[model samples]
Target: MRVITVEEHFHHPEVGPRVMDLSGPPPIDLDADFSTFWRNFTPDRELAEQLAGGRLEHMDAAGINIQVLSHGAMTPGSLDHPDATGLCRQVNDWLAEQISQYPTRFRGFATVPLYDPKAAADEMRRCIDELGFVGTLTQGTFAGLFLDDPRFEPVLAAAEELNSPLYVHPGIPPASVLRAYYSGNWPASVEFLLSSPAFGWHAEAGIHILRLILSGALDRHPGLKLLSGHWGEMVAGWLDRLDEAIGWGHYLDRPVSDYYRTQVWITPSGMYSHNQLKFFLAEVGADRIIHSEDFPYVVRTNVADFLLNADIADHEREAIAHRNAEALLRISPL
Candidate 1:
């Protein structure tokens, strides 16, 4: 079966380092597993910036026929740089060039300057219509506010109008959230992990989805396509609770779970847990589940094997592996 993984990430050669604080010193002397797995984890930065020669080889090794690349956690969209709008155009132009090199094996998700909603919407349109990008990705929050904030409606409206899916990637928490919840009681490295990949990042992403639902963004833009990774960022497991509890005082046109089922698509994002996959398959159905490796971060090369051995029917497996992504993202099948 052909495998297409979304949620694959890469770093922009120039703009990435300038905005994302990539020069921090590595943390040392911690628990072996946490330190080795996360704290000491260093991705191949050169390979991250490479496409034709480097990333394609890794994709072949892992049996991924195509990868939809997007800027990772700290995307230009989440920053407050003075030249953010120009930087976003530059980044998307670079990404479009890379995808043009191997249009079959590589696709792109545009990086928008979310700090300015109108400019972000314009960039998103240019990416989809002119550059042939599949969609746009909004990384976490902008100025500590999630997409549900009224200021972000223009981008949301553009997405609905363009029939493009918006991939919601996690981002670093606001300082207040970091200090209040993830600090104190651990080393700085541990605190950083706590605020990021360990727990906070997923929760932050999940909360944004809930806010969109409760705040009626989904209701207003009912045709919006919101994609979530990490198996819907823990929201898939709690749909029942969210619907049941929030249902009591709900004022929306539909139930919370209904919006999830209709509007949201979920990917595992390299967390290869069979139980989680099974739960999502039941909760959201196979049509809503897509495959992703979160490449260079998780780096599990046995992706084909994992999906092939999954305890699902052949049709369902096909849907998760490539069919769903092709349908949702409009990729041509091999």
Candidate 2:
């Protein structure tokens, strides 16, 4: 069976040196710049290969056929540099070159300068039309602002007009959020186990996607395609409770489930739990779910075996593995 992994990650190889070279350094905190995720990434030979050309070797080792890669998420100060717009173009073009090298085995989502929404949308268009990218992926808030803001309407409008999907990846909580809930210094191992990204990012992702729903962005562009990973950041679990607003019938034009079922897609990146997958299937149906490995982050390469051995039937497994991603991304099956 063809296995298309949608939650793969990459950082622009030039990003670090480029950021360090910026003229006026931006504020380094999470009020806007929250990259507890990628700020500290240091590449070894193995990591370098994964970020660049040698990705195919690992995919072959894992027995996966194709991978859909995206930059992890944008932190506030990342693109706040004077040369940010140019950097966005550079990253998107570099990804296009990488995909062009192995058009069959790899494809990528575009990275935009989210600090400027119009520039972001314009780059999104350029990636999709000019570079042949599948779509665009961003994570968390836009400089501490959610997508519902009118400033982002151009981005949403472009996604609708161009038929490009927008993926909301997980992001870290802001400084205030971390200070309130995840504050305190423990040993490095203890922080990694407790507050690092494992617990905080998933909740942050879950909340961001939900905010889009409650903030009525979905209602504006009903045709917009949005994606969430890790079983929708646990949206399936909390969806019903969120729908309690249906009792009053006061706020939304439709129930939250309607928006989720019709507008959103979910992937199980690095989450191989059969129970969680089963619950997502029951709640959102197989069509809205897809398969992903989250790549180097969760670093277990036996996903083909896991999906093949999952308790679900052959048809459902196949749908999650390739069918849904094929339809959404327009990639042919291997």
Tens digits of per-residue lDDT for model 2 on 107-156?
88887777778888898899999998888888666456767778888888
Error of 1 at 326 (Å): 0.8
lDDT of 1 by residue, 258-280 (tens): 99999999999999988888888
Q: Which residue pairs in model 1 clash with each other?
A: none
- What residue pairs clash in candidate 2, if any at all? none
Instruction: Quote the positional error of residue 331 for candidate 1 in Å.
Output: 0.8
When summed lDDT is taken over every stretch of 10 residues in candidate 1, the lowest stretch is 22-31
Scored by CA lDDT, what does every candidate get? Answer: 0.86, 0.74
Clash numbers, per candidate: 0, 0
Candidates' TM-scores? 0.93, 0.88
lDDT of 1 at 195: 83
